[model samples]
Target: MYRERPAAVITGAVLWASEAGPDAPPTRVLPDGCLDLLWSSRAGLLVAGPDRRAHLSRSAAGERWRGVRLPPGVGPAVFGVPADELRDRRVPLDALWGRAAATLAERLGPSPTATALAAVAADRLAAGGGPDPLAVRVAALLAAGATITATAAEVGLGPRALHRRSQALFGYGPKTLARILRLRRALALAHGGVGLAEVAVRAGYADQAHLTRDVRDLAGVPPTVLLAR
Candidate 1:
């Protein structure tokens, strides 16, 4: 089973995936500039960092996993690590948090479910001073295909300042973020059964060739393969 929902105390979402059959294939997790605190039935708590490309993960049949996905720019504040260091990485929570990780592990107890994991994330966010509204705005603007210069002006940040913040928050510059966001937009449209050419235009790509290149770059596959499952 797989299910997801908006989180109550945070700006992102929570999701859980469990084995459906004995021969279930590994799942492909796409990049979306978010970080996750995951609790696995076999592995306890782990941190799944932001990705620049898709990740393939497998679980034994009947094994369950729960995760709290934090909004971009919010994980560093809660975990006390730079986004750049964690990019494309998954590490044991204890590695980053030591005693705090152990305490949280105990609080989550055995067989931690998604709701319990979300509670732990909520507590951590409260302790870390909560989510930054500006980061949310920056993400929204970028996802909407706004130019970095225009986004900076709207957010009242200079170009250099925005670049620095983007690095810390997204582990990349605005241009890279825009590319990722555009890829996501195109994929969403494709999933909705839109033609590839129309998807490119709607997702702000220059053409179908541009969309295909980006899909291959970020997803490690062409759009057709990615959308086929």
Candidate 2:
């Protein structure tokens, strides 16, 4: 079972929980330009970094998991590291926070709830003085289908400057984040029963083939397979 809700403690963050059944198959987690603070029944506290491609998550049977997913750019503030450093990796919390992570692990006990994870992230983010305003703007513009050049201009940064900042804030250049966000937008439209060709056009793709290639590139599956899930 899986469920998620908007995190009340942090804007644009999500609190989610899942329990794997004995028969559960490996889950494909698509790239969403976000980072997650996770507490696993089997693995304890862990940090799920941003991914450039899909992540195949194989859970132990009956394992329980809870996580607080931080928005892009917001993670670097809470985790106190550049997002690029942790891209495509899932590391133990102690790897980043050291002794502080140990203390937090003890506080979470054997089983942790999504609310607890969200609280910890919220506290740390507040202490770090919150996410960069420019990051927030860039993410918003990209997700809204703005071109990279336009997004950079909107944020008052040149192409090279924006690319450098995006690496630290989102673990990739603006173009990559833009592609990921576009895939998400396309998927949402497809799931809503929109036709594939229309989904491509509406989601800013050249056509259905363009949509398929982008989905396959980032999600490691064709759109049909994803929609079936």
TM-score of each: 0.93, 0.99
> How do the residues 87-146 of candidate 1 rate in per-residue lDDT, one tens digit apiece?
899899999999988987887688787777777777777887876677788999999889
Q: State the C-alpha lDDT per candidate.
A: 0.83, 0.94
Candidate 1 CA-lDDT value: 0.83
Q: State how far residue 158 of model 2 sits from its true place (Å).
A: 1.0
Instruction: Tell me the spans in candidate 1 whose CA falls farther than 4 Å from its real position.
Output: none
lDDT per residue, candidate 2, 21-113, as tens digits? 999999899999999999999999999999999999999999999999999889999999999999999999999999999998888888889
Q: Which candidate is the best by lDDT?
A: 2
lDDT of 2 at 203: 100
For TM-score, the strongest prediction is 2
Candidate 2, poorest ten consecutive residues by summed lDDT: 104-113
